[model samples]
Target: MRLKGKVALVAGAGTGIGAATARRFVAEGASVVLTGRRPGPLAEVAADLGEAALAVPADMADTAQAREAVRAGVERFGSLDVVIANAGGHGGNAVADTDDEDWRLSIESNLTTCFVTCREALPALVESKGAIVVVSSIAGLTAGPAVAGYVTTKHALVGLTRSIARDYGPRGVRVNCLCPGWVRTPMADEQMDELVERDGITRDEAYALVTKDVPLRRPATAEEIAAICLFLASPESAIMTGSVIVADGGATAVDLPTLAFA
Candidate 1:
């Protein structure tokens, strides 16, 4: 096991990519502390993971709560070898409709949460010479319509990841980010619903429209994304740091001219 004796802290571990990563990490031999805003889901995942996981419910958007979660993880595991800042979502609002609350929520949910968690866990990570994986999005690399706040936050995460990598690489703490394109998660499903309603298209049509630019013609599964996270957290990627691993079904790689036009 690449992570056999390591301790990991995973934010947003209740569901989606975070849950999958936590499960994968535990299976590969790491003690993980799972944190999420909801207690029931987090506790369920922790219970399912048996003694290898600890559920610590905390609202990661709050700086104090984020710090407390990290502290709880260290206390439970005695050391921290990996930190996965995976808590983020689309607090939906178009730029024209987005008020201060929408903008603040997006920042707190996606950007500030990562900063708070990383800031609190940096000391322990440095001590263990650990790795940090920030879950960003392809939206971080390119602009998306109608998601100004989310796009901005995700883009900021990439910069934040690079900053940490540059500052900590020599210090033995590796920092990197995963820039996933559209993945088949609950959030994606919800976004699809919104798209269907907004554009008055069938669900399948909406899916096809979204995947039209992707070379693979489909979104990634949650498991696929989790596998990449496992590799980044594992020793196999020891030499990899400060990189944005794009798992977007080739969405970010294709030229517009290559796509077949109807």
Candidate 2:
């Protein structure tokens, strides 16, 4: 309800956090334009949200498509009050195993998409004095094992968030990064499958294996992350900008040696 009368552009809205955010925004009395690479899922989400939502399929990694998504959203919704750059994915085997394409795709999906979304939405966002909540990862704040390309791109999003916030804060646009740890989403599910296959373990075992380091002892739900995005997108987080908010179940708070003692 905090976002009553607002309009938001949510990239990667085909599913997971993006879909969840679109739902949350609608429930809070906002009009949402959902954009993603997949039209099927995006259409499904748009249908679910009824008249409050519109789906536009766009690959945010491309500048032209990113611009068009914003344009279409504005044309339908009249103005933009928030932009959620929630599109991203993992890449690379490890630093030693990663190839050029791995790095390129990772950067495109995770970092470039975010930059392009913010760039295209800034003019409208400035007019509306709106907010931009970028979805980075806990890896952005701290390194993770065997995900070199993902780690690099997420870390870069932190810088992008801060830079955007600093440059545009005085212009009435707010920018902040959400550093989420493990979450129960399609991306995380894919990673779980990879872990299971790589280690020859069951699905539950793979989940526990990855979540053992989390203080909460489980992965976050997409709704949980979306709730934070709602807060950041609303006036409740008015005092916060350029903040790297970590909602990782305390994964980054513990010292590795301390964990060993535990």
RMSD of each: 2.0, 1.3
Give all TM-scores, in the order shown. 0.93, 0.96
In model 1, what are the clashing residue pairs, if there are any? none
lDDT of 1 by residue, 44-131 (tens): 9999999899998998778788788888888888999999999988656678989999999899999999998898889999999999
lDDT of each: 0.89, 0.91
Error of 1 at 214 (Å): 1.1
- Candidate 1 overall lDDT versus native: 0.89
Off-target runs (Cα >4 Å) in candidate 2 are 198-201
TM value for model 2: 0.96
Off by over 4 Å in 1: 195-206, 257-262
Which candidate's lDDT is highest?
Answer: 2
Count clashes in each candidate, considering only residues at least 3 apart in sequence or on different chains: 0, 0
